[model samples]
Target: MGHGWRTLRRKILTPNVSATYLETRGFRRKDRESQELLEKVGALFLAGYAHAVEASSIADVEARLGTIEHRFRGFAYEGAGMGYGMLDGLPFGHRHHNDDFLAGPAADQIYIVYCGIGWAMARLPRFRWPKAESLDPLLRWLVLDGYGFHQAYFHTRRYVHEHYQAPRFPWPDDESRAYANRAIDQGIGRALWFVGCTDVAEVARLVRTYPAARHGDLWAGVGLASTYACGASRDELVRLTELAGEHRPQLAQGSAFAAEARVKAGLWIPETDSATKILCGQDAETAARISVEMRPEHVRNGALPSYELWRQRIAEELMSLGGVSK
Candidate 1:
């Protein structure tokens, strides 16, 4: 498309900037610092989305995304992933946009990119959803994590307060379909961190309102978001660890995943180090190493997808270390 048309497309496609504001979304405003940090994340995400839809090529998108600060840069790539995923879903656009992005500029940001596609999934019609066959078998579940986060973040009353769960997610077109809701719940768990504005007690209370069975996944999500997003203080993180109790293993597992993501993307910050230590009881490098070492070679083996198995292995490993309870 021409530059003019692309600019128009970007304007039309991107959500209003106000959508990122805490007041606009009715999300909690626990503290000024946390609120500002989360809002900046939203702004960076939108900036990345704009760049992706308007840029002429992947290189252009990469150049624009690189301008984002190191800590927030992954989020921009994530937004770019969403932009490319949206473009790929459009009737007139080539289907290879996400593929090209994953193979190129998004290589190190794969986890965030896959989650970004989930955001596109939330916006795109069900018929236009990216084909399950095209995604990584193990990590594709992260897309649902993205989707769940989108729904919970934007439709908090239903997905969060009401605890609504998608009955049977029809993506991926496989036997693993039944597990889709769990993956999405993990995403919702992540959103709760933002919705609570990084308030440890409030986030925990919200998770408690859900069914006991879902608490593990939800807490895991919280761990991922709190660690990856880095809005909470050392005290808040410790409080979260105390609140997690029996789910600490799952929480540690999620934290480890965030550690790996930040470390791999070269976005590791002081907050990452502190969060990993407090939540996972390991330094960022060791926590990240645990996540890497525990990854299953295959994407599928038993009733659960390899992703869940990978998660299980990580949790198990962490629990064995006595850092988190069994």
Candidate 2:
């Protein structure tokens, strides 16, 4: 497809647009089965907290989260799969395996999990939602992908490009909003998760966040989140990759290559390479092309690899002779 046609195709077929026009504004259009499922998950956490939400101990909350993860797994390839939901969810009925979950149910898991985190932090009476500080370093580390998803869910959308560069601080509420503003709900949600864990140092925090709960999905989220939002130094990401190799080589590979992809696409800061410096033209087209080109080499017809084999090879090609410390 030509670039112009691709642009239109994206506007029509992109996942976020489906969620926006179909789910958020018109969720009630088809009786909101998907939204209701999300609410059920939220209510599970709310009830788990004895209705006090964030009042529960970390262990208690995590135990409930275990139950919630089952729902997410249902959306994964391992489970029954997302099946594009019963309503106007993102279409992947034709997708074979986990990509269906990646494109579809993953978003649902994120929004619902983000809500659960907020609920766990919130108290009644005043009903104030703190900045999620109550979640200790470990718990905060746990939701890195959901946090990244919360943001990428919006930033990756066609609407943000049609509207503006990205959302600014002092973000407007949905009642008074544009595509960028509303779409950034994903990022804003992730920011809260990030802030909750920021009290710890970047590398340590990312490492702590790498417990093998959701396996590759969680690691992939970390890879993208660190690249797009963590604002860590290049050296730090290298160290992060090394550390991830210890836990799961794929985790390391995912972060390493994801960082490379984002840098090439202008979505990330430049590292040591001068080539990347020029790549940072902030040209959206370049980013889009990089995204298209980033199909994990050798995967025919765009079958994304597991976190282990995904982008690490590309990262190897991009790395300089004197790269991060061993």
User: For residue 165, what is the lDDT in candidate 1?
Assistant: 86
lDDT of each: 0.91, 0.31
Mark the regions of model 2 whose C-alpha exceeds 4 Å error after superposition. Answer: 1-87, 90-220, 233-252, 255-308, 315-326
lDDT of 1: 0.91
Candidate 1 Cα misplacement greater than 4 A, ranges: none
Q: What would the per-residue lDDT of candidate 1 be over residues 1-326, giving only the tens digit for each residue?
A: 79999999999998887999999999999989999999999999989988999999999998999889999998898899899889988999588998998899889899999999999999999999988877888888999999999999999999999999867778778888878988999999999999999999999999999999999999999999999998988888988999998998889999999999999988999889999999888999999999999998867823478889899999998878877774
Residues 80-134, candidate 2, lDDT per residue (tens digit)? 1111111112242222222233344333333223333322221111132222233
Q: How many backbone clashes does candidate 1 have?
A: 0
